[model samples]
Target: MMRKFFLVVTTWLTVSTLFLGSMVMADTYWIDVREADEFATGHHPEAVNIPYESIGERIGEVTGEKHADIRVYCRSGKRSGVAKATLESLGFTQVINEGGVEDVLSKIAAEK
Candidate 1:
């Protein structure tokens, strides 16, 4: 009986650890809240362009879940700030404003 209980506990712990690790490694989306022209000029390799003006309308199309971590940037801080606000209002809990294109690029480079 004791051996069986120990085996169950060990299995539970291993499964729990794997589940938590996967959650911690969830994808973080990089979004560029710039217009098509600006985005076409240049954007982060991992970023998806969702123009600031259309953020509210395309929220579902851009993000997978409300609680997903999202990093946003634009031509200037202004648009990203707007996008961040819109996302929060729409129930997104982890929207981060990464400022302009250059700023985000530097940040991504630093992370690497």
Candidate 2:
């Protein structure tokens, strides 16, 4: 009986956690345009790694709505600049080249 109660509680907690995580992801995300290996080393928790080259093809996977707000960053902002242009070409009306991760994170925190 104790085992069954523990399983039920664990399952409920898992489901609730997943639901809340999905809710946060669905609302907003900032893209990290660094390569996969580079991104693996370090990145912001909420940042999604989508290399600038692949962004044109893969951005739709993140958001199909062309007008959705999009923020992008990389090591020195160069890659994110390309990403910004690519997103704009793809009809994403609100693309922000947020530069480095630290800079962007601070800006996001400030905004919050």
Clashes of each: 0, 0
The local distance difference test score of each candidate is 0.89, 0.85
lDDT of 2 at 30: 79
Measured over all alpha carbons after superposition, the RMSD of each candidate to the real structure, in angstroms, is: 2.8, 9.4
Alpha-carbon shift of residue 70 in model 2 (angstroms): 0.7
- Worst 10 contiguous positions by lDDT, candidate 2: 21-30
TM-score for candidate 1, residues paired by index: 0.80
Instruction: Name the runs in model 1 displaced over 4 angstroms.
Output: 2-21, 110-112
Question: What digit string (tens of lDDT, one per residue) describes model 2 on residues 6-88?
Answer: 99999999999999976755565579999999888777778888999999999977887766678899988999999999989
Candidate 2 Cα errors over 4 Å, as ranges: 1-26, 108-112
Q: Which candidate is the best by TM-score?
A: 1
Give the per-residue lDDT of model 1 (tens digit) for 29-110: 8889999999999899988888998998987876658878898999788999999999899889999998999987787799
Which pairs clash (backbone N, Cα, C closer than 3 Å) in model 1? Answer: none
